[model samples]
Target: MLKGKHEIMLKTSLGDITLVLDADSAPKTVTNFIELAKSGYYDGLTFHRVIPDFMIKGGDPNGNGTGGESIFGVSFEDEINADSYGLHKLKLGDATDEALPEELAEMTQKEYLEKQGYIFNDDLKSLPMEKGYIAMANSGPNTNGSQFFIIQRKAGTPWLEGKHTVFGKVTEGMDVVDAIANTEKGANDMPVEAVTFDVEVK
Candidate 1:
């Protein structure tokens, strides 16, 4: 288990980027990332997907945006914050509004929240998906593996809200991310010149 805040250093061919994982909000995901980094799982992987003004994606062993496994070799669920969506605004008669025991027993926490009219707001929507935000890349809900991406634009990506998992943010060196994102690419969005990564976790 992760004890406290953790920082990951990614030394890429373009340059170095540092990330501060959100352990408090996404502990399991943070721990998984740390373990993968320490084991050198991301040492030589290439950022396969690069769309200028969008984001730069990597962490796929195949370097084709199709292959990677979590440390447990299985998929994991998302860890989104609930208060970000005004769920805390709900109140009942003379009491703090909360899901009843019957509701909790019948459906998952996310389902219960949705039933209460709380749409999953990505990073609260208030916390814009600005430049340098790092999020997990998944096939669908709860499919986060080793693959992840870094937002390359200063504008907020509200479209991606509630869809992908934002597990961390770039603490420094977004210039390297921008450089990689601006690189020339061929078919399949693959960079013409390889951009590999080596991570140091602390």
Candidate 2:
């Protein structure tokens, strides 16, 4: 197996894309990701969602945002508090003052509500979304599973910073991620072509 940080390379109609998984910050999520990759859970999967500012989501067994069963389900990982890990906020500026477009603003608020189950610290710190955030999608806290997303962009403010389970970040292959973001797609945001993936530990 590869050691330390590792890469999962793929061949998509959009070209080549590689994603680097961080083992340290998101041990469980990374382990699960590596396992799924090795099991070929991502083989022939297509990008299901492609909202430019949001993220490009895939890893579904059925090629739809809602598909994934056999090896695709994810149990609720622990809620990752940004402060607990001594992690600074990923948003920028006065975080309290900077205003973002409504669409993004709404998402930021929604992210906070999902994490309400956990107690929060009012003290603020500075952390960049680029630090290494692997955000999980969920109906509520401890409700996360296989489906996840990397923070391609930083949070607009700190109030919007908390609430997301950012288990890890990309240590390498940012170019690949950018490339995938730039790929052409169709339908409910599915990539026009297929995205097949395989994972292995180094």
Tens digits of per-residue lDDT for model 1, 126-172:
22356888888888767888999999977846456555667788988
Taking the tens digit of each residue's C-alpha lDDT, what string does model 2 give over 4-85?
4656665554555455655555555566667776777766676666555456566666556664532335464443555643
| Per-model TM against the reference | 0.78, 0.63
How high a TM-score does candidate 2 get?
Answer: 0.63
Stretches of candidate 2 exceeding 4 Å from the true structure:
1-6, 69-74, 84-115, 118-128, 131-133, 154-160, 171-173
Cα displacement (angstroms), candidate 2, residue 120, comes to 7.7
Full-model lDDT for every candidate:
0.76, 0.52
RMSD of 2: 6.7
| C-alpha lDDT of candidate 2 relative to the true structure | 0.52
Candidate 1 — worst ten consecutive residues by lDDT sum?
A: 87-96
